[model samples]
Target: MGGKSRALPPTRGTLIERLRDPATAPAAYEALVAAYWKPVYAQLRRRLGLGNEDAKDLTQAFFTHVVERGSLARYDRERARFRTWLSRLLESFAANEHARSQAQKRGGGTAHVSIDPESADHRLGASAPVAADEVVESFEREWRRALFEDALEAFRARCVELGKPQRFDLLLRADVTEVPPDGSRPSYRTLATEFGLELTQVTNELHAARRELRACVLDALRARCVDEDDFAHERRALEGSDREIER
Candidate 1:
């Protein structure tokens, strides 16, 4: 509880039915949008480097387009993260930077909510500090990092089931207090103290936890592609936590 839990709490039936039946399920659409909107917008602003106005518009239009355009089906969780594939789509959108405006003009074509383009632009452009490119980069390149996080979540849930969720909590909250000049990773000592464990025990648990998480992430990414080679690259890309594809 030190910081906000960022992972989505598991919701079994409602979200699945909604994702599966977006056409008729009003509740589903809202649920999907609620879960994804921030991440989508976060990708736009933090990785793609869009201005606040453009990012906001992009976020709205992205979800609208996904629902209407029958693109969500393309998101196979097995092969890629919802985030990585999303990053690619976002890149395509960003490459055609002017398209969001035009897409907004066209609207959802189904009496979808009529969002004001100018208002979105104003909101997106509200913050000038973060560049579009930075956000975009974060989206694509975070495959490994995101996967690690997902793995961590999976591990946490697994531990919770085993009645020891707090045991590995510290790894979930790993943070850099001081940057090593050479960019070396922090030692297990810091993590041990934070989680209240002996150094040796902490090291072993960290290894098990990270390994499990890595495996979980790779498993998720593996299900996304038709080609094994592409999947391998995606897994490898996560190693350096760098962008796998150039936009």
Candidate 2:
């Protein structure tokens, strides 16, 4: 099974190494915050029952703590997934903040970490409250959603680079979304007629777009995994029993 699996990229270790290096820390930290802040904010809102303003404040504070305190240096890739490690760190930070009555009232200690309260509110509105025992589950769910969103953005940029923005739009409209909303699928013939193309062209472009999106998703997942084994585990977790990749 292992022999059939694709070789995992070294992005995860490379990112960690960059975070640990003073020369590269600033840029790496920014990337980290961009990649993760949404899930962290969502987790805070769902787990601790925080409002949008407080969640945004705490999200910024968490990243600020990571940068200023060099807390990411304590990450042990051998011990756990980076996601788990960061989640634990966030939980501890929230606990400590709650312990300080003044800090709790003030929202958070860091002012430099800016998050969009409106975006957080929109996300919160889309979901029901998660049970306390299911906070980790909630965090993982949000993380996967964020990861796929990042992949979709990457796919969109690639489509623009390849001069096929229309193809991407078609793929999203026809395959990704349920615009019909009654479980009724759109036909390639109809899409081809709408776009003034042959049915085969619509089919081929949709296939290509799907393949690119899948690759982008895998690339995003590779960036977050601590190692090859961790990558496999996360891929399984994300893809479930439809495991196209071997163990």
The digit string of per-residue lDDT tens for model 1 on 1-247 reads 1111344433335343446664645655664554455556655555444555556666778878877887776777667645556666766765564454456558733434344676466446544433455654665544444445555666767778878665557556553235668875556787677677899888777677677666666654543322455555666665665565566
Could you give candidate 2's per-residue lDDT for residues 1-247 as a string of tens digits? 0011122233435677777778877766766776687788887766555666766777888889977896876788788788888877777776665566456457755434333676466556645656556766677878888888778878988999999998889888787776645666678988888888898999899999999999999988877664577778778777785456578
Clashes of each: 22, 0
lDDT of 2 at 205: 93
Which numbered prediction scores highest in TM-score against the true structure? 2
Q: How does model 2 score by TM-score?
A: 0.75
Each candidate structure's TM-score, on Cα atoms with residue i matched to residue i, is 0.51, 0.75
Query: Which ten contiguous residues of candidate 2 have the minimum total lDDT?
Result: 1-10
Best by lDDT: 2
lDDT of 1: 0.57
In order, what lDDT does every prediction score? 0.57, 0.73
